[model samples]
Target: MKEVILALITGFIVGLVFAGFKLPIPAPPAFAGVAGIIGIYLGFKVMAWAGPMFAEFFK
Candidate 1:
């Protein structure tokens, strides 16, 4: 998607800037940390998808 591409590009640029300045990258440095972030995103998306169904059921 266009948004995905844009995000990748932006991240790449920021990474380059950080590397150029010899600064630490502003993100998780390990796979487990990255997986945690993915898990959080998935949790949020799953809740968003299920919320309406639950609301309808309750009503």
Candidate 2:
């Protein structure tokens, strides 16, 4: 359980940092870029955080 939570938190933070830093990446979608991965992960993390918080208050 602890490891899962830690993984979640680390993933979230790393994703945010990646997006915030806006590291350079090549154009075109054909590339398996690290930046792209970070962006997607950040999107998922944001959704995860918002979903639970919003649901709790609304219910």
Judge candidate 2 against the unseen true structure and give its global Cα lDDT, from 0 to 1.
Answer: 0.74
lDDT of 2 by residue, 1-59 (tens): 99989988987787677678995323334456667887899998997888886786766
Tens digits of per-residue lDDT, candidate 1, 1-59, equal 99999999999999999999999999998999999999999998998999887886766
Top candidate on TM-score is: 1
**Where is model 2 more than 4 Å wrong at Cα?**
24-59
**Alpha-carbon RMSD, each predicted model:** 2.6, 12.2
- What lDDT would candidate 1 get against the real structure? 0.95
Return the lDDT, model 1, position 57: 73
